[model samples]
Target: EKEVNSMIGRNPDFARRVAIDFSDNLASAKMLIPIPDDFPIMAGEILRVNTGLDIHLDANRRPVVALVGVSLMGVPIPNAWLGNMK
Candidate 1:
């Protein structure tokens, strides 16, 4: 996080335009966030997770998470997995 923060320090307008949604097509992470059995996991809900990142691009180019390996309960789902998830 320190590395990215450093870059933003010099530029004040960096935060003005966050093209977070632009990279929706390219998702480096596809995780299944844990939730209650009764609770529903919508596409929007999953992407809005506060798991620190957003999977966005500030300094790291093209989504920082490249690990296709799913982990414990894992991260929130990416846009590509919507059709696959029944």
Candidate 2:
């Protein structure tokens, strides 16, 4: 989830790019994300999308529950992102 934190970093605009409402139950399930025909896609592909409550104390010493996780939406695209990719 470090990648997610880097993208969001408590920024509103960055956070909006990810879908936080998604259920945790759906995160682990393998889903097919159709992409361009030129690229060959093997069946039963998996993407690591997630959602969670990051509960911790801020600089002000107040409890904060921040929603954090990667929400890479599944859809037709040129390529799928892998964790090792830069």
Candidate 3:
């Protein structure tokens, strides 16, 4: 977590860009985030999207696991898994 915070501090522009991209994608209902090969797990943890795992087949017919439905900007939104359960 500390490392990721440091990285964010060092690369504010990249972080801001990512936040904007995440917001845009969310607004468009495109929730599948393409995990970068070099993305840090700690960073993902910081974003709080480290849970929702889904299996998808890649172009080579290989199974790939990825996180889905997790927020990017830490917005206070309802859980995507559980619909309005007032």
Off by over 4 Å in 2: 1-50, 70-86
Backbone clash total for model 1 is 0
lDDT of 3: 0.44
Task: Report the poorest 10 consecutive residues by lDDT, candidate 2.
Answer: 24-33
Residue-level lDDT of model 1, residues 15-40, one tens digit each, is: 33222221453433222343555666
Candidate 1 accuracy as lDDT:
0.38
Who wins the lDDT comparison?
A: 2
Supply candidate 1's per-residue lDDT for 59. 73
Candidate 2 clash pair list: none
For each candidate, give its TM-score against the true structure: 0.23, 0.23, 0.23
Give the alpha carbon lDDT tens digit for every residue of 56-79 in model 3: 577999977544444455554557
| Residue 54 Cα positional deviation in candidate 1, in Å, after optimal superposition | 11
Clash pairs, model 3 backbone: none
How does residue 38 of candidate 2 score in lDDT?
57
* Model 3, runs deviating above 4 Å: 18-65, 70-86
List clash counts for every candidate, in order: 0, 0, 0
lDDT of 3 at 13: 57
